[model samples]
Structure formats: C-alpha cells, structure tokens
Target: MVQLYNNGAYLLNGTEIIEDNSEANAKLATKLGANVISKDEAATGTIAYGILEKHNTSGNMDKLKIKFDKLTSHDITFVGIIQTARASGLEKFPVPYVLTNCHNSLCAVGGTINEDDHMFGLTSAKKYGGIYVPPHQAVIHQYAREMLAGGGKMILGSDSHTRYGALGTMAMGEGGPELVKQLLSKTYDINMPKVVGVYLTGKPQKGVGPQDVALAIIGEVFANGYVNNKVMEFVGDGVANLSADFRIGIDVMTTETTCLSSIWKTDDTIKEFYEIHGRKEEYKELNPAHITYYDGMIYVDLSKIKPMIAMPFHPSNTYTIEELNANLMDILADCEKKALVSLGGAVDFKLRDKVRNGKLYVEQGIIAGCAGGGFENICEASDILNGASIGSDEFTLSVYPASTPIYMELVKNGCVAKLMGAGAIVKTAFCGPCFGAGDTPSHNAFSIRHSTRNFPNREGSKLQNGQISSVALMDARSIAATAANKGYLTAATDIDVEFTNPKYFFDQTIYENRVFDSKGVADSSVEIKFGPNIKDWPEMPGLTDNLLIKVVSEIHDPVTTTDELIPSGETSSYRSNPIGLAEFTLSRKDPEYVGKAKAVQAAEMARRENKSLQEALPEIDVIINKIKDNYSDVNNINTGIGSVIFAVKPGDGSAREQAASCQRVLGGWANIANEYATKRYRSNLINWGMLPFIIAKEELPFQNGDYLFIPEIKKAVEEKQSEMKAYVVGNSLKEFTLKLGELTDDERTIILKGCLINFYKG
Candidate 1:
C-alpha cells in the first residue's frame, strides 16, 4: 500500500510526480513551458519549507533558530518545564503557553501528588500569564487543535505525539527543555531538516480507517529509517478525500514513523475544521508551489490498504488482520520470540495460548488518546457496535474521547448511548491508556488497542515483577469489532455493518467554564503553590578536564525506547521531584542501574568535597592509578567520576526529558550508542549535559562494569573535535575511539556549564 522513492522527485503543478532522473529536467521544462527551477530553489517550494521559513530567525536557511508561536505541555511534563524555566529566571511567558492536565488526571497514585500538580499548573498560569486546562477537560493535543492550532503557525509541545499537520499547523514535540528555552525567550537551534513528500492518492476502502493507513506507512518506513529526522509533507489529490478527523488520525501517528514533523497541503476540508472549532480566521490556504521538489517521496494508495495490526512489542511489526489469522500460530510464535528480546526473559510471554479454535483472542480493547479518541473514529466504532453487546467475558472495552467537547457531541448525537448500550464504558478525556496509566491487563493477557504505541511495558505490565501483558495496535473500528465478538480478534471488514457517519458540533462553553485562562496577564503578587513532594534539582558540577566513566549497563537491543530508559505510568507521579524520580531510572530494564550509578556518584561526591576518593569508593584507586600511567597530571581535582550506559540504539520513543535527565541526576556523564533513534532524544541528552557518545557498531572495547578514561575530554568538546580516544582501565588499558555528532556552539556551552539550568544561571 506504500511505495518509497529511492531518490529525489519533482511535483509538477501539484498533480504529478517525476522522479529525479535523466529525463526529470526535460519533463519539468515541458510542463512549465521552458521554465525549470534549480533543485535548491524547488526545495523551498514545499509546504514544510514555507512554514519553517516563516518561523526561522537565523537569516540563514542552513541553520534554523526558531521562536515558536505557542507552547504546550501536559501534567506529567508541565511542572518540570515550569520549574526549570523558573530556575532560569523566567519573569513571564514570552509566548502563549497552555498547561493541560490529562496525563495525570487520575489522582489515584501517590496521594495528592497529581492534584497538587494541577494546582501548581493553575497557579503558574495565573502567576506567569499562561493558560491552564483542568483535568478531564481535554488532552493536550486535542485542546491545542480546538483552540491553539493556526494555519501557517508553529507550535512546540512536550508530548511526542504533538502533531497538527492536518490542521495546517507545523507542530513539533520535543523534551521540556526546549519549551523552557521558549519561556526564556531563547531560540530553538537546529540544522535545516530535509523534507519528504507523502503523496497520497485514492480513497480508503470501507473497512480501512486512518490507523490502517498509518500502520501501513509506519511498517514500510520505520525499519529502514526512510523519513528519520525529516519532515513529511502530505500533498496529493487524495487529501481532499478524507475528513478533518480522518486526516488528524493519520497525522498524529506520524510520530511513530520517527519523522521530525509533518505538514499537509490544506484545502476546504482543513478550513472547515477551523471553522467548526470557531477559529475561522486562523485558517489560511496552504499549498506547495507549482514546481516543488522533495528529497524523497512516500506514495500511499489508501484504497489498497487492508485492516492492519501491529503485533506486540512494537508499532512497526505490522501485518494485515487477514494475514495474521491465516497464519496465527506462526505469527504468534514469531511475536513470542521477539518478546524474549524485549522482555529479557523477565517473564514468560506467550501469545500462542491466546489462540482459541484457530482464532486469536484478545482480553481487552481500548479506543483512547489522540490517535483514536477523535470524533470520527469513535463514531464509526459506535456504528459498528450499534446493537451488539460486548458480552460478559474476559474481554472488556473502554472508550475515552480526546476532549470534553467531543464527549459532549458524542452524547448529543447519541453515540455515547449506543456505546453504553453495547456495554462499552466511556471515560472522560485522559491520556492514561496511551501511556500505561490505565487499563492494565492480567498476566499473559493480550490487548488490542487503537493507541499510538505498543512497546513493551507500555501497556502497564511490570515485567521486573514477573508480570507481563502484550498489546497489538489496530484501528478503532477493528478494536470495536473485536469487542463486539466478546474476545475473538476480528477485523471490521469481516462484520458487515453500515456506518452512520454523524456530523460533529463543537462546544466551547465547557472549556470557558472550567479552564483557567490568564489572558496574557501575569499577577506579580500571586504566590506559586508548592507541594510537599515537589523538590528542587540537585546541584550539578561542570565538566572536568578528564573523565572516568563506569559502564553500568550494557543493552544490545536494536533500539531502546525512552520507556526503557525511564518508565512511564506510576513513575509519572515522581516527575516534579527530580531526585525522587531518578530513583526509578532504568529500574525496569536493568534493576541494578540505580545502585551502580549511585556508587559512581559517591566517588564524584567525595572528589567534590576534597575527601579521599579511595576511601569513598574503594575500587577507584586502582582505576585512577592505571589512568595515571598515561597522564601524570590526572588527579582527583582535574578528573570527574561518573557512569555510562551502552546500547545499540537508544532513545527511540517519547519526548520526555527524564529519559536523559534521570541518567544525569544519577551521576551519568555519557551514553555510548551506535546511533540515536530520534533527534528529540539526542536533544534531551544534550540539554541534560550528558555526552552523546557514538561508538562504531562493532564489538565493544569494554563491557559492563568497565571503567573507561577519557583524558582532556573538556578540551576536546571545546575544540569541537569530532572524535575522541578512550581507554578501558584494565590490565593494559585497551584503547578505542568515540565520535561526537554535530553540536551548536550554545550546546557546547551547556555541556561546559553542566546543563541548561546552569548555562542560564551564568
């Protein structure tokens, strides 16, 4: 259903695609009557380039320094972002900021911790001239879509699925430090990213929803890294075929493809979306120029797409439901094998046991979060289950509308009644299901979800405790179909049901009555509320002349998600407190990571206090003596001690800064990986003042518990050296090289100062 172009291509008059070959220039010239633009000029003709150009303030296209039009964060992230900004001398919000309490809406964990965060958000909005959406009102992205998204505008959010391209807004989801930068009136610095054209044609089939199309695209591109760190600009005649919610369902899931951001060519469909939301003036016509070029193109034929599923452990492990059922045992066996790698044998994960009578059975189904909670997806799901019952079985179904307004409309249009009548429990607006906070299944149970990710432990199973469950991603229609069957996995196509597509009506009164809008007015006399659990960040030391890093953990997983780096769900309650949250760092993956890192941190603490490092950490004497063999000047005063972790490719999922900051606060100084999975993760490491060390993908020079010494590490970073030498403090000090990727000058300063908070303190 998806075809990837191997090379650059040209779009003529937005109607045709001509591959960049020998005849490309001639074809373009023929179409434009002897007028053909250069590749560089045509590159500027994309919708992505235009939106970026409008926001870029660096005056140089090669390097972008962007100041976004707005900023947003959810409860799990806003507290920390505001705390960081407050520490960095934030007087007032430089741009419009919205704090939505959806991630931690369920105040069931850690007592009053979640509600205290809500109060903090409300007070911070009043004190700093921002906006605050109360819990159960709306999830972050849905609220932004209904209010904040504007055509030809740029928005930055703290959640990874922060895409609004279908609304003509170029929004990026980065770690909280980036939002803090905006709060401090600093610019977001990055190199100009490549733009890829996602040219869609043909309409989707009756049973195929946007999730099917999204999974199809993700399955094709995620493994090969075709659109990594690049913008996916959707452009084609098929754009006119989908409704606003259909396009949104596909756009929000672009985060799964590892793309930087996405933008769509807007038409009357998108304009109507704005008008429905009561922001008609924000709608602006956006389209690529007549002659536009893309570095690559992904051609998607929606009509050919089938009802799809991404098997347990990842969103990229995709197959059609028909294909899966025909070869149930084989696919289940393969998924079990993959689970061994993902779970590390912590629990006995078996999917074959879920098969009954040659058909796969799932225990739970969820249609929630930004991807599935849209009105159209839920309406179609309600239609598919108009008069059917979910039955009293192991299978349970729950639906959560993305926003209160959607819930109101669903109630108004009787979709809620139909869903409730069929035994589906409808909840308020919350992102818990998407990130492991809700709907946890029993051990060995299988779940079918319409959420964004299906990663390990992302379904709320604690593998370290010998408990595990798995989730398979499907569309809302398929999930509802499965629920209607009570337990048996079924595709919407197998059940012949007429969909009563209903019109949506937006209601703004709910938000107006419940939400706290500062109206861009700050009250200097207002006191910022502080919860007892909230804690300030611990002091961090700047980079020393030399470094000694102990490799505490070694992971060979092809890719390590942020969830592995620092888990979500229950741990989200500790997010506002830095040191308290660090205790859970790598708790699920390594279990011993925190203890090992703390031992290394103790040596650094001794060094900082001018105490005997040998007495504090008994084993440090031998390693320091061996390091002294090469450089006699290396001493406790000139060298720093810390820990590191080596993974094949780390930081794949989530834009949460804690993935890197948790490591930082626990005495981690560097990360050794073959490569990083996403730009946002690398940025998180940099913002946290951790060295993003890149080792070649060959056999390692050191193993876990090996102390590696890097002399003059600070000097190398200051000199902008691409590569550095490191020695394993063993019998003979085995040597190896580590590479540092591109870093801006400001980034170098942040490293030198220890972190963004320190950089701004100066």
Candidate 2:
C-alpha cells in the first residue's frame, strides 16, 4: 500500500509528481518555461520549508536557529525542564509555555508526589507566566491541537508525539532541554533537514482507520531509516478526502517513522477543525507552490490499505489483520523469536499460548491516549460495538477521550453510553496507557491497544519482576471489534457495521474551568513550590584534559529505547529528582548497571576530592599504570574517571532527556554507539555533557569493565576534531579511533562546559 521513491521528485502544481530523472527534468523545465531550478530554490516552495523559514532566526538558510511560537510539556518533563531553566538564571518564560499533567496524573504512586507535581506546575505557571493543565484536563498533544496549534506556527513539546501538522502547524517533539533553550530565548540549532513528500492518492476503504494507514507507512520506513530526521510533508488528493481528525491520526504517528516533524496540505476540513475549536483565525490555506520539490517521496494508496496490526515489541512490526489471521501459527512463532531478542530471555514470552483453537485471543482492548482517544475514533469504536456486549470472561475494554471536551461531546452524543452499555469502561484524558504508567495487564496477558506505541514495558509489565505482558497496536475500530467478540481477535472489516461519524463539538468551557493560563503575565512575587521528592540536578564536572571511562554495560540490542535506558512506569515518580531517578537506570535492561556505574562514580568522586584513585579502587592503579607506560599524561589529576555504555543503536524511542541525563547523573561520561537512532537522543547526550562517540568497526575493541583512555579529550572537542584516539588499557593496550559526528559550535562548547547547565552558568 506504500511506495517509496528512491529519487527526488517535483510536484507540478500540487497535482502531479515528476521524478527528477533526466527525461522528467527536461519535461518539467519545458512545462515551467524555465531551466531546472536549484534544489534549494525548489525547496522554498514546499510547505515544510515555508514554515521553517518563518521560524528560522538565522539569516543563513543552511544553518537554522529556530525560535518556536510556543512550547509544551507534560508533568513527567515540565518539572525537569523548568528546574533546569531556573538553575540557568531563568527569570520568566520568554514564550508561551503550557505544562500539562497527564503522564504522572495517577497520584496512586509515590504517595501524593504526583499531585504535588501538579501543584508545583501550577505555581511555576503562576510565577513564570506559563499555562498549566491539571490532571484529567487533557493530554499534551490533544490540548495543543485544540488550542495551541495554528497555521505555519512551530511548537516544541517534550512528548515524542508532538505532531499537529494536519492543522498546518509544524510541531516537533524534542527533548526537554530543547524546550529549555526556547524558554531561555535561545534558538534551536540544526542543519537544514531534508523534506520528504508523503504523496497520498486513492481514498481509504471502509473500516480502515488512520492507524492502519500510519502503521503501513511506519512499517515501510522505520527499519530502513527512510525518513529518519526528515520532515514528512503530506500532499496529494487523499489529503482532501480524509477528515481533519483522520489526518491528525496519521500525522501523530509519523513520529514512529523517525521523521523530525510533519505538515500537510490544509483545506476546508482543517478550516472547519479550527472553526470547531473556536479558532477560525488560526486557519490558513497551506499548500505547496506550483513546482515544489522534495528530496524523496512516499506514495501511499489509501484504498489498498487493509485493517492493520502492529504485533508485539514494536510499531514497525506490522502485518495486515487478514495476513495475520491466515498465518497465525507462523506469525506467532516469529513474534516469539523477536521477543527473545527484545526481552533478552528475561521471561518466556509466548503469543502462541494466547492462540486458542487457531484463533488468537487478547485479554484487554484499550482505545486510549493521543493516538486513539480522538473523538472520531472513539465514536466509530462505539458505533462498531453498538448493541454488542464485551463478554465478562477474561476480557475487558476501556476507552479514554483525549480531552475533557471530547469526553463531554461523547457523553453528549451518547457514544459514552453506548460504550458503557457494551461493557467498556471510559476514563478521563491521561497518557498512562501510551507509556507504562497505567492499565497494566496481568502476567502473560496480551492487550490490543490503539495507543502510540507497543514497545517492551510500554504496556506496564515489569520484566524485572518477571511480570511480562504484550501489546499489539491496532486501530480503535478493530480493537472495539475484538472487544465485541469477547477478545477473540477480529478485524472491523470482517464485521459489517454502519459507522455513525458524529460531529465534534468543542467545549472551551471545560478548559476554561480547569486550565491555568497566565496570559503572558509573570508574577515574581509568587513562591515556587518544591515537594520533598523534587531535587536539583547534581553537580557535573567539565571535560578533563585526559579521560578514562569504564565500559560499565554492553548492550548488543540493535536498538535501545529511552524506556529501556531509564524505564517509565513507577520510576516516573522519581523523574523530578535526578539522582533519585538514576537509581533505576537500566534497571530492566541491565539490573547491575546502577551498581557498576556507582562504583565508577565513587572513583570519580575520589578524584574530585583530591583523593588517590588507587585508594578508591585499587584496580584503577593497574590500568592507570598500564596507560601511563604508553602515555605520560595519564594521571588522576588530569584524567577524569567515569563509565560508559556500548550499544549497537541507542535512543530509538522516547524524547525523554533522562535517557542520557540519567546516565550522566550516574557518572557516565560517554556513550559508544555505531549510530544513534534519533537526533533528540544524541542532543540529550550532548546537552548533558556526555561524549556521543561512534565506533565504525563491527567488532568491539573493548568489553565491559575495560577502561578506554582518551588523552586530550577536552582539547579534541574544543578543536572540533571529528576523529579521536582511544586506548583500551587492560591486559594489553589496544588503540582504536572513535568518531564524533558533525557538531555545531554551541554543541561543542556544551560538551566542554560539562552540560547545558554549566554552559549557561559560565
């Protein structure tokens, strides 16, 4: 259903695609009555380039220093972002900041710490002239869509699903430090990114929801890195066919394709969406110029898209419902094999056991979070399950409206009653299901969710506790169909049901009654609240002349997500405290990571205190002496001691800063990876003063506990040297080269200054 263009293409008047091949270029030049334009000039006509140009503060288009119109964060991230900004002499928010409490809204954990965070958010909003949305008020992105998004505006959010492109706004989900930069009135620095055209054509068949189209696109692009870090601009006839909500559903999931951000051609559908949300002025007609060019194109035929399912372990592991049902056993076996890789044999993960009499059965179905919680999805789900009962035998269903307004509308339209009558529970707006914070199923249970992700532990199973469950991502229609069938897997297309596509009525009063908006007014007299669990960041030392880092953990996993780096679930309660949350670093992936890192941290602490490294760790003297034999500058005073982790690919999933910050807090000085999965992850590492080193060779030069000594490491970063030499000092000194990818001057300085905090402090 999806076709990827390997070559550049031109959109002729936003109607036809002309590949940039020799013959096609000739025809296009003749049609335009002009010679072939420069790729840079052609790019200016694209919707993405237009939006980016509006936000770019730098005079040069090659190097963008972006200033977003607004910034957003949920509770899990806002506390840390604001805390970092405050430490860097932040007096007030320079731009509009919205802090939504949806991730950690469940106050059941940590005994009132969650609500305390909410209160802190409110007080910080008051003191800093920001906005705060209380618990159950709205999830981050939905609220942004309903209120914050506007045509051609750029918004930065801490949550990874921060995409509102369907509304003609270019929204990006980045690490909290990026937002911190925006709060400080600094620019988001990046090289000009490639823009990919997502050209959609034929209309979607009945019962195939937006999630199906999204999963199909994600499946095609994710593994191969087709759209990695590129802007995906949705264009073509199919854009006009889909409603605003459907377009949003597909747009939000573009984060799964590893794209930087997204925007789409807006029409009356989007104009109506703005009018419905009471922001008619925000609506603007946005489309590509007559001869816009894209670096690449992804042509999708919406008609051929089948009811889809992304099987357990990842959103990219996709299969159509028909294919999965036909080849059940084989697919189950393949999933089990993939589970072995993802789970590291921690628990016996079996989806085959869930299959009963050649039919797969799931324990629960959830249509929640930003992806599935939209009004149209929920209404269609309620329609599919109308007059049907979700049998009480080991099966349950739950629905969560994205915002209170959506919930109110559902209640008003009787969709909530239909869902409740069919034995489904409806909850308020919370992002717990998308992460691991809420709706944890029993051990070995399989849940089908219409959430954003299905990554390991994202379904709330603690592999450390030997409690493992699985989540398969599907559309809300199919999830509801499965629930109607009492959890036996069924696609919505198989069961013929008329959908009642009800109109969405925005209720601004719900937010007006609950949300705290500062209206751009800061009150310095207001006191900032600090809970007992909330703590400032630990002191970090700048890069030393010579550096020594122990390989504390070695992960061979092809990709490591942020959830595995620090985990989500109950550990989110400690996110406000750096050192407190660092205790859970690699808790699920490597249970001994904290202890091993702490041991190395002790040696670093000893070095900082002018104590002998030999006295702290006797083994360090042997390595130091061995390194001293080869190099004269390898001494405790000049060389700092820390730990590092080697992963094949790190920073795949969430934009959470703790992925790198947690490592930094636990005495990590560097990360060795073949490649980083996302830009946000590498930025997190740089912002936290960690060296993002890349080793080119397939064979590892060092093992866990081996010491790598890099002489003149500080000077290397300062000089913008791409290649640096490192020696593995143990039984024998083996030297290898590590490469640091292209870094901006500010990024290099951030590393030299220890971190963003230290950089600002100086």
lDDT for each candidate structure = 0.93, 0.93
- Give candidate 1's TM-score: 0.99
lDDT of 1 by residue, 313-403 (tens): 8999999999999999999999999988998988888999988888888999999989999999999999988999999989999999999
TM-score to true structure, per model: 0.99, 0.99
Most accurate candidate by lDDT:
1
> In model 1, where do residues sit more than 4 Å from their true spots?
none
Off by over 4 Å in 2: none
What would the per-residue lDDT of candidate 2 be over residues 1-762, giving only the tens digit for each residue?
Answer: 899987888998898898878687678768877556776688889999988888999988889999999999999999999999999999999989999988888797998788888888999999999999999989999999999999989999998899999999999998999999999999999998999999999898888899999999999999999999999999999888899989999999999998999999999999999999899999999999988889999999999999999998999999999999999999999999999999999999999998898899999999998899999999999999899999979898989999999999999999999999999999999999988889899999999999999999998999999999999999999999998899999999899899878888898998999888999899999998889999999999999998999999999998899899999988998899899999999999999999999999989999999897777888888888888888876676788999999999999889999999999999999999999999999999999999999999579988998999999999999889999999998777888999999999999999998999999998
Residue 415 error, candidate 1, Å: 0.6
